[model samples]
Target chain A: MTTKDISRPVCILGLGLIGGSLLRDLHAAGHTVFGYNRSRSGARSAVTEGFDVSAELIPTLERAAEEDALIVLAVPMTAVEELLDDINTHAPTCGFTDVVSVKTAVYDAVKARGMQDRYVGSHPMAGTTESGWGASMTGLFKRAVWVITFDHLMDAEKVSAHWTGIWKDVCQMAAAVGSEVVPARVGPHDAAAARVSHLPHLLAETAAIVGDNGGALSLSLAASSFRDVTRVAGTEPGLVRAMCEGNADALLTALDEALAILQETRDHLATTPPSVEQLADNGYRSRLRYEARTGHGRSQESVSPMLTSSRPVLRMHPGQPNWDKQLIHAETLGARIEVF
Target chain B: MTTKDISRPVCILGLGLIGGSLLRDLHAAGHTVFGYNRSRSGARSAVTEGFDVSAELIPTLERAAEEDALIVLAVPMTAVEELLDDINTHAPTCGFTDVVSVKTAVYDAVKARGMQDRYVGSHPMAGTTESGWGASMTGLFKRAVWVITFDHLMDAEKVSAHWTGIWKDVCQMAAAVGSEVVPARVGPHDAAAARVSHLPHLLAETAAIVGDNGGALSLSLAASSFRDVTRVAGTEPGLVRAMCEGNADALLTALDEALAILQETRDHLATTPPSVEQLADNGYRSRLRYEARTGHGRSQESVSPMLTSSRPVLRMHPGQPNWDKQLIHAETLGARIEVF
Candidate 1:
């Protein structure tokens, strides 16, 4: 059965950055949220901050199940399997979900516990250089992309309907706090995260390590580009290790692809200057498309050329007399041709 | 002898983004500025914008030399040799400088032309995604690093004094708009640029290319991190190629170093989820150092622990009674220990 009321009880397990942010937002949205943290001081701190929290896990899960609550396991990846095992024994019938960066391994573990019917895996693609509850806030997920995925337990229609009900409530909650929800399956989600999130984190770490090895002179000369690319490298070691280990296979695949590209660029530079037109075009188009999607760019233009197109060359033909005005007129008409 | 007046004429022999921006800043600083562009349209546009600009090169150089002006060759890397030859043949006595990303090649060419006594090679470590005069504006180099180098042909003190007077004017102009000027020799400057600038550009290109090859799904998931890292990849292809080709030797060295780091990280990930503490610590420390240098972080504190030090263990001791207050008090004293 689906939830009849939107203000039902919501339980959060592990009050780290993501969990803390969720609890604050859910509580502010008028839902009763019970926060569970393994640390006694953390639970007490949550209570002092006016959040209903408990240090014990089993009792919290039992109480939350009694209220038919949505239980979100927001712990580190290494702790996910143990928590899943605990949930199977304590509250097997509760609605289950998690906010983990890697989804396949978690989903597989959940399915191994025979709980695929009621579980969804999600990741909120938003964070900062800082971590932990002290750095979290209610608006942490605002305008961010929250990806949701699930195992194929039932028939297509039934599963769609089942998830639609839960996902609708999730979308409503996310929207009320300003975030967008996207749906995907386990494999595609993991693969996409490899290319986008995991690989970029590796790049950050690599950049930081490289600069550190270059000594003080290199550090002094390093500016905006290096800083921007390496910003994520500053995250906590334990946290970064957990994230990387969780998505090891996918991250490796993405890293291989990135290395291949880097090697080709280097070879091209070593021999002769590489033709960077395609790379530049791809980057330009990707940025434009992203900005438009996020509402950060101007209104989209109609009939824009494809990024892969190698047409409509722009050059000066001084020999073609009286074509200057026509060239200006063509540019006004969005022909995108530039003439001298 | 050093110029008697600070308002002596300054001539810029290119109307690209850097040259145009320099002209705007120097003119605003009350210097008698002369602008020249190879393209007639570029010169005309500068004139229309209420600046003294000419399309004719030799005549402009002759006029500026007569006034003992400091001439800046702000053209492309490919054009530097021809421009230096022209300066040697037509205006040998004027003080000279060029704003190129790579310094050694330009310095060599200047020395080859028997102009080592007068020419200084400089690079402003600042730019935007856009190019050309239309994108140029005052304060483009604000809060940026401007590196100046020379061939060291004359005696130390006389050369130093000569450069000091000219460099003072350059620094004053840059500081008037908020940029710091650094002096370095050619080789070290090139090597530093490889690690800090050229390598990052290659990374951006590599990232863009990898994303483009990942099909539409990967493109969809490539968001903020991807965008930040690949921002420099969208630059004009010709310009990027020139920068990369010009710094080929140094870039190869930097790329090899980066590849070693990447391979090490990959091998570690492959075996038993390698301990990433060192990598993470380096990243964290590098980011903090960068932020501190850029004035983006909080004011300095005394006696911060080194990132490499494995000390002050943070753990919960169940046997210790009355330790809670100690832990809290330690935290208040800026200790980074986290206790369960």
Candidate 2:
């Protein structure tokens, strides 16, 4: 199938912040989009806001199957296993993707449900402290990294033409919403997420706990740096819990590595004229390296959106050898692909 | 002692970011102020910018002594010891305050130099990641917390009237520069700084080390939370070292507490369905509590520079019994004193 199926209607399985915002974005990008929310009140509110949303998942999945629409799982991590069963039963072989924080768990759930063939996983790296229907804004993903993962699959040669078409559809939606797709593999994505996302939440929680233990006086004196370090602590607890648990192995490793560094620093701090100079210097350089890698692309949002034009594009085809490896490498080098 | 003394001439040493910015704010607030920079290039640049800056330390201290101007030690922590001797010799009786990051360290050094009678200590809770003369701005201290520490003194009654007058002048500068004076005791101030400031730096630096160890692909996947958590790691290492080493005892305690939390979380993460819900929930609540404590005052910066008008004022005479204790309590309760 030489597919140009970005025009296909999309069905979203949850109408939380990510799902609700995605529905708005897909609609604005001229795609036929509808969503389902488990909360009846949330579904009703979205419907009242003039979006096509339903409280019932079965009918929504059936409609997606009928129209060959790509199903998007925008639900919580705890909801993914049960939702996969619903998808396998109702939507059958219809291709789908998710906006979940962790990738390997979703990959495992899809394999267990025998829906792996139709699954192209994604983790949209965009959000605010607020959550739910009211917090969802149309342009939330603008200039954000929409990470696309197909690395969990055994081989690119196993990805059928039909599945490739589905993956293309997902990339189209990502681009339409003004995000650059960074390709990552299943295991590595979660591992990376553990280091950069989940571990930070744990650290922030620990920081908050420590800050609070000092009572009101300590909290009162906390300045900008303390505020920044603990800012993620302000995020919804359910979200953090789901994200951390879903990627426990990688997160545990991350916690260990971070703890080792802290313990070393703590030991040195006990000596006369405390020695954290190396760590501090290395940390400063680490931040600079990250800044160099990401550049000012986030700050350089364009008024009009397009399908992967501005950034250097890496053209690739379906069934290429080590395609996942190539894509991840290309991503690290600041390259994007329109679709696989 | 009524502090019509806000008009008193001010002399500052070390034209680094904090000192340079303080000079601008003080001048703009209608105080007679001049600064000295050891780096001739820096002094020449400040002079070119129409600020009265000198390259010679002796002459500057002599002028401050002759005019009985309040001296501000805005030098790096390592340089602090050497400069104390200069202050003791050239401006023997001139009252002074410091903008050092740690209070107890400065308090100890001042006492050893026999300059305790003429010294007040402050940690201006305001900064940018950037340092140096060029990065300093006129309103950098606007709406910032000017933490005043007098608790290092053995007793409130022991504070001579002249020193009280000097403390008042410091508060006047804080208020004039649009900062809220939060009084803290010497020991408690360093302890609080450890929990909120120094400990967070260690955490952030550790985070940076962990993130970097993940290599380029992992760095590529990092997002906002990672950015926020490691933002403090971007600060100058020397500054961080001085602040941390100056308060190593408190910092070590904080580090131990944080590591315990991480280790506990890590141990649980190895179980069936990882249990981080308690930590997650507590962290979220802790953040909300801090927001409640700080309010939105930092964002609610007054267009017109203030001298203690917007917030409630707590009046107290210097040498009152437990005056430092009262000030810390008042600060926790959101009240600011005009002066000591």
Candidate 3:
């Protein structure tokens, strides 16, 4: 049931940035990808782009079931429920994964439908300020880190037992699209996303609002630092809200931590003259460490860090012993995995 | 005494990124710029690059005094005091200004030295993450906003009346180096720097630290949003500390405001699930407004906002009535000024 051939036929149930880009990259990698966009215009655009796309959800799901395709939900978080409902009715046996920014909500939703055993989660950390199908491209995921997560809410043994075929297909698709897969658990993935991704979105907006309040003269003097720090604030608001709100606990924890750090700096600055050597030094060293690990200078383009060759990638075997333990350990170490 | 020409011989102290770049740009713009660096290696490198630079501070200042050349302090904030001590002894009559990040610190230092009237502050809002003489370039200030501020702690009438000759020279130099001039008061300028520049640095470093603390797995999944937000955190630690600490009170105020904003969002997220529509929407609109004013799409390259053609430019004349009031008004409006 498990194969290295990612041409297992990908059923993408949305044609926005993530989904559209996935479809294009998979197509370029010589896969059979069926792009399903809810909007007729998006489907038409995909068709014009010589992509295999369907505007009808039922027909796409039916075809996916027939092919035993890996159904990928790439829609907005709010719209995930309805799409899941439709897929459950028509393609329940296909096995599904999602490219949502957060994993906990999606995992909970899947578990609610008693479909946790058939679901995998992906969070591809690549994008620009631009979004939508118009911003989609073949090289969007080139050398990006695609974090593979699992829903362990069900009996861990049962879920790990059922995880092979679909997980292997997902890994193959990710590798085919030029991404390195990093295994992560659902809770930790959400928390980390809240810290590194969702929290940053909130901070970007908050900082932007602060700069805006700095008034005309202050703004006139703003430069690259302000421009860069506030860059993500310009992203589509609805998208920002979806990811931030979906991971509430983790995001709140991140916000509180950031607030505490900033407050400490503020207190230090209350001195007649201030010395923020501690804050600045620690930050500088952290940046250096990040660069050292990622192997990129990070001057302009930001790509995800790849797993070093020394670490092991999990290759699943039928009825493998201690499968759940291996999954947890790999995820905690941020190591890659090959489910096949 | 007042002329439209910026061809006045210039003596630049401390040939680091700011001073070194200024020297190159002024030379390219056909002005005689004498560079002075305390470090012999940097001075030798400048000489090798065919720039006129001095390894001896006293001799450089002596020459500047003889020529009545404008002495520009391009050193770090910590180094400014000693350099001022040397200048007071060697080039007291030269009438100087600086390219420092914080105006109030330099202004206070100048006022304490009884040289406030001779000092016109120039903070050109530009630079990359890189620093030092090697990183210096000619077009660093191209189309950047050079903020012109005064040390008004002295009698306002006296400062305004004594400002024209040295102030005009500073403006001419800024314009020669391809910059627009925006006038501002020292206090407000420092406060604004706290919000727009200093605060962003703190935020960048804090966010970078947060990401690093998110553990290896979290960092593996970080993408462009995290990169851009934390870019300034990679700046030279000394430089970061200097700016953040030099504007201590203002930075504290800014941090408090940002903390308040973030806390509100955190409280809202405490609900069953979060609805961050308010935070995201306000931020999005603020970013749009900023873009509209700056006339830069801000996708990557970030330029300072420019004054529109409709705003009046303040021009100072000898014995001009209400010069201080005019300067304050122009600064508040964020308008440009032409000095002769």
Candidate 4:
């Protein structure tokens, strides 16, 4: 396809953090962009902020229906189904996509609506604690992963080429805004997010309970650590709630595993009659192992409990030794090393 | 007993992060500060960094034995017992204090040595991920909390006056270094540290496990959230281990409570069929509560979790309505009123 045939005007639904940011970025990149928000005030704000805003979804879709355009549903996951339904009826005859966190359910929804062929599932893992059109910046998607989920029916070459173009545009924006794009499959994305993103929210909520139990004075003593750990809890509570509710199963699994680790550490502390030095050594070694591995850029594959049990190829590198000597040293240090 | 009679130079043991920072701050405030370290390299580095360094502990104590000086033990808690033994034997003439995290044990150690009258337990709640002489910044203690623990034998009025002078110097340093001074009793400080200091280490350790499992790819995908949560883990492994072992009981308690709350949230997400919006609402509200309570200028009595039972008192202006009405309004509209 020629550049003229490939490039078209873009429609962004729900001009909040994601939508507004995407609109700003796309518009700045010289792409004709139109924004639609359910809230009239939000739409007006977008327009006032120099965006081409449409007061209603249908009219906006109708105006941009031709020109082989792309419509991005940049709302929350809960709003995806309804937005898709509306889009199915009033969507321009072109490709459609979304910026929702979770993808499986939305993919199923789109498939059920018979729009699977032209629909792409993408999630840009970029955000801040703030929300709404006012918080949106022009460079929000710079270098952020614009994940495009592919199915069997999708033309691999066409879809890949189309996404590469979109990513080129998006990556520049992401980099400008200090973000990066990472592509991963749906299940892994959900699981990884549950651990990194959703887990922080849960921890913050739990920390907040300390404030709830201890009065304001107790909370006042809360320093940088408390503030940093619970920073995500201070985010949009509705969004946090939605994430927990949306990715319930994966979060539960992660929680169970995390709690098990904590309980084991607690039990060891309670039951083990070790010297203070010995106890400190245990925590130190464990923490050191974690830190060294993290610093070396090891991935989840090497440390996941599921994978560890099945494949025994994971090993730790000691400070100064050959591979064989390092293996022996690791064994001496009581580390679990497996040769795959 | 007068200020003029107290002519002995203050000896600071261990010139690492806290110790070095304290020496710099104290010297700048016109106090004669001498530093001793177990690491010859650390001592040499301290001397190179313009600190008066003593090579041997006993010889150093012997030199200052005739003068009515103060000894501040700024080493890890694991080393406290050994340091106390040395002080009790050779430094009987000098007044002593310590900057260990857990105070009850250190206080008991001093009491057992029959030096309770001359000893005050102190803990300065200020730090960074960096350690050693290189990481020591002169401004590290500018506005940071320098908690001085006193007992029955210590004259409340005299100690209070002395601490006031010390606080002025330390508080100035804390402000200079961008930290806040928090004053609290020993038990409260430990409990709060358990929540704020100790918990972050554990959380970081846990987050680092993801890197261990995932290898380079997953580690690369690790975003700011993971980095922030795990930043503390990157500190001196030995020091972090010492802290966890020293404050094991309180830390374990805090960890258990944190884990329990996380588990409950996980279970709620799994079993409870709450609307996605409600989940987000809860997260938003929880975060708002935490943010409102954080930051300096708040009294220790105001934000103490022990007194507040986790429910922070939402302060309002005279014209504003009651908190309940405001909460109700927020809940209905999915908004949180966070006024910090």
Candidate 5:
């Protein structure tokens, strides 16, 4: 590919955990990266940590304007609208993406800025309890889902190619670090995350509240099990609150469903009193089924778009296993298998 | 202590995880340990793993009866009643203790045998998810709580002396291995454990149910947050089911309270949303308070019962710092530190 055809110098606005980590990963992968942060200290820290950081939004946007493609807005949802306004004024020529968890608001904001063709809503599902430049690691997005929103206004081929290239690089890194990177449509992705991610934080917070009221000594005795259940509760409260506020309806629905399930299980135990063996058996069978269907057992390279897509220009390397055969086998069998 | 005063060839009935680990720890502490398991293979494995294992329970009990003063029932709660009955008939003179999680039923059984004077109901708050003799480790009780239940029928001095000696040694070993051992009464201990331990398992089970219902692909996107929250859900479902069934009332109560609090938070978010900073501050404050109260922040040696209690003969080694200084200071400031 010509230099003009390649994606390079990917601009990332905001040098927080997600942004900083992405900048680090892309930079290490031989792409030039420029990071913008509202805080000068965050920018300084990102620079020290090997990112090309800029404090002023306009200057950073100017640098990004020179590049033909791929500017990622990695700031919080609350900041996205303001950031988009700035991006419209300064970096109007560049194709853009964002890592915002909540999409509808940011999507509307981007559309309002008349940048719908250039901007694709994205959310890379990866992070730790920690935040900021200090906690940023190069391998953060190694095996994480990088959801890209597709709409009617976008150039399908260019957008797909841009996302596919980034996805391929990220998938390789994820495999290297013993993780998985999957793709999904924006709505399903948000709903699923709200259920598994946002709702758990609420549950953890509830447990913490119980512990606080019951007595701290009782909370202290919380072993790995309690710690695991409520770990997300221990996250920065402000971020968690923001997440819940941003995705309130979906999160509330998930929480209600979860509470209902728990209540039903509790009621069942109270009345029917099923055998422990039966409950355990059900759990094992369910987990087994989940593992079977998810392609969790398959290697990352086997599912990459580069390996599975019908496009003829990207030829499979010599000695590379025929992933299509394994994919077909998996699809036929409706489960995972050894692909040798 | 004199050789006559020291218990020799202590009989540990049921060579499962607890029994096997105790055998290893007690043996390492220069105390003779004899083990018996219903499974011959388990006994053989224990012997192969360098434990003093015996295949026949009666012979092991008879041999221990001739030399030892103490017998520890390390079987499951279901097995404890039968073992206690057998011990009452076969080896009536031995001072007994148990390592069962629940205490009320076990206490009643011991009392029914008219052996309450000779029995100290104890539960070591430590273990792994793994079971069997092969899963045993030496430092299992290190820095782990060893709750001893006391009643009016028992001699306070003898019970205190016996437990003090055993727990001090175990506590010291726990500290050496970077573990903490706290002591508590049965009622409060079980209540607290239900909240911290049992409730989490139930919560995990509920999370797993959600995972199972959602498409498997959605479940695979289950990041570290989901995995952390649901890790204990993978525990032997039968065992967890039994635990929930056995401790149903307490667990249900805890679950109700937890759910109610979560519902309230959900409502708060849905109606009048709080600032993100306030939520984060609350979480941070709660965690800090929890750490401070639990002695989780204190050095292991400082928090040991050997240092906290006033029994001179039961004091920890001279080099160990006085951890009770905080307790003493709190007391001086009119804080009531209740000891049961």
Candidate 6:
């Protein structure tokens, strides 16, 4: 697709953290971007931040429909359906997308409204503990994953014509802001997100609950580790609630898996220390692979956003010489190695 | 009490990150400090880093005993007993301390060795993902919590005469390096540490296991939230294992509590999204309290290493106008007012 074919005016419906950040990126990419926010303060802040956002949703929708703009439903899960209903009534022919975390729920909403041809579900796997326009930044999505879901939602023709164009446009826009877009089906997208996103939030929430019992001692004793682990619990409560509720089945499954692992660790702790240590070893290996993939602690030049051809292989046998050193080497090489 | 009384030579056993960091701090505080490491490489690294560390353990122990040095056992749980046995044989009368996570096990060891009068259990609540002497820094323990335990092991006389001197000396020494030393009993310290430290590691490990099921899709979807929540899982596997195993009972309790909260959230999500939102709100409130106590996301000048008197107050009821804003305002004020 040519730049002209992809250069449709972008209308973002919620000027929250994700929306505002995307607006900043798209505007920086030289797109004609308009925004609308439910809250007066949010709209005002978006304007103050130099983004052209309308206070009324209908006017933005009307203008988007007139321009056949790419409409992005950047609101929470609970608000997506209601906004989509408004769009369907007011601008029925406009193709649109959403930036909600849970794909299945939004996909279901699109399917129910028979607006699948126009609607795509996208979730940018990026955010900080804080939310709202004030906390939004242009760099928020840089080098982050922007997952696009469409298998069950779009028909083949719409998928090929509209979505193909939309995908390239979105990816190019994201790449301009340093994001990589990955295509995914709704079910798998929700499932993977549950493991990496929703589950962590739930875990953070549960940890915060655990911290409650210890009184002031917990506060005094909590260091960097505690702060890191429970940081997501400081996220916007509405978002957290939407994440847990909208993706209940997947989140529940992920939670079950996590609890099983923790329970096994607890049992091993009761039996032998080495067994629990082995569990920790497994976790370390997983995190090592993740860090290797994401360039978390490494120098930017040495890290890649994608995996390398050299894969680390772990051999489990009796008397592995210098296994720790081997693990460290594999970690530096960004390979997953398992040694037993 | 006095600078003269506190200025004793210090010997740090196991020249790992914590030990090395402490050595740098104490040595900077103008104390004669020596270190010992089982590994030759570790001792060499310490020496290269300008700390006086010996590979041979016995002579260092003898020297420490002669100077009445505050010996810090900074080894992992597995090596604690063996080193304690060596110390009991060589420096039974010299007052010593440990920097292990679990206090009961080491406290029991001290009691068993009849060295309770000389051995105080201390755990500095600070560390990074990296370990060993190479990762050590002068500010590792600065502004960190250093919990000292004595009520369970030390006799009243030893507590007053020896522990008081040791406590003051250690506190002053830690404070000089910007760490705050707090007195705690074995039970409370272990329980709190289990909640804040051990539980987070288990949670991280569990999340890592969950990510394993999804393969690279999990990696693609994992974001800052995943990294933060699972950051502790990236910790040294042996250390993670030691933490979980050493304090199995306390960790088990914490895990149970977390599971209960999570299970309740799952149930709430099934009934009403608002209920789950309430749970998320509770989590946000808890995290806000923690942040207010610690300088996690605030200006350094505004944040205290210790908790402040201004507590956040949350009053949540139906028809409450802008409760979310109210919560944020309350968090800023740090008052615990709940209107639910």
Candidate 3: tens digits of C-alpha lDDT, residues B161-261: 34567787888889788877888888888888888888888888888888889887777777778878988889999999888878887888888889898
Cα displacement (Å) at residue A27, model 6: 1.8
Chain B of candidate 3 vs. true chain B, TM: 0.92
Candidate 5 residues lying further than 4 Å off, grouped into runs, are A1-6, A151-179, A269-340, B1-8, B152-179, B272-284, B292-340
Runs in model 6 with CA error above 4 Å?
A1-5, A152-160, A272-275, A297-340, B1-5, B152-154, B157-163, B270-275, B297-340
| lDDT-best of 2 and 6 | 2
For residues B279-334, could you state the per-residue lDDT of candidate 5 as single tens digits?
Answer: 44555566545545544432443466444211111222311344234333322221
By TM-score, highest first, what's the ranking? Answer: 2, 3, 6, 1, 5, 4
lDDT of 1: 0.68
- Candidate 5 lDDT by residue in tens digits, A150-181: 44223332333444454333333333332333
Looking at model 3, residue B37 earns an lDDT score of 87
A1-340: candidate 6 lDDT, tens digit per residue: 1234256778889878899998888787777888898989888878887789988988888888898888888888878889989999877777788888888888878889888766767788888766787777887887677775545322353243665455545545555556655556778788888898888888887788788667776776788888888888888787787777788888878877887777676667667443577678888888877776666754443465544322333342212454335434432332332222
What DockQ, on C-alphas, does every prediction get? 0.22, 0.62, 0.66, 0.22, 0.35, 0.36
Q: Please give the RMSD to the true structure for each candidate, in Å.
A: 14.5, 3.8, 3.6, 11.3, 7.2, 10.8
Best by DockQ: 3
Residue range B168-238, candidate 2, lDDT tens digits? 78888888788878787777778888888888888888887788778766677777888899888888898
Docking class of 4: incorrect
Q: Compared with the true structure, what per-residue lDDT tens digits does model 2 show for residues A1-340?
A: 1124484788999988999999988877667888899999999999998898999989999999998888999989889899888888898878899999988888888877667678899988888777998789999988677888765344534677777777777887897888877787778788888988889889998888898888766776778888899999989898898899888989889998888788888878888767888788988888777665555232332342342223456777645776666676675664566664
TM-score of every candidate relative to the true structure: 0.80, 0.92, 0.92, 0.77, 0.80, 0.85
Give me the TM-scores for chain A across all models, comma-separated. 0.80, 0.90, 0.90, 0.73, 0.75, 0.83
lDDT of 4 by residue, A3-34 (tens): 23225567788888988888787676666778
Q: Is candidate 1 or candidate 3 better by DockQ?
A: 3
Worst 10 residues of 5 chain A by lDDT: A309-318
What TM-score does model 2 achieve against the real structure?
A: 0.92
Candidate 4 stretches greater than 4 Å from native: A1-6, A152-180, A272-340, B1-8, B153-181, B210-217, B272-290, B296-340
Give the poorly placed runs of model 2, Cα more than 4 Å off.
A1-7, A152-157, A296-313, A319-325, A331-335, B1-7, B296-313, B319-325, B328-335
Clashes of 6: 19
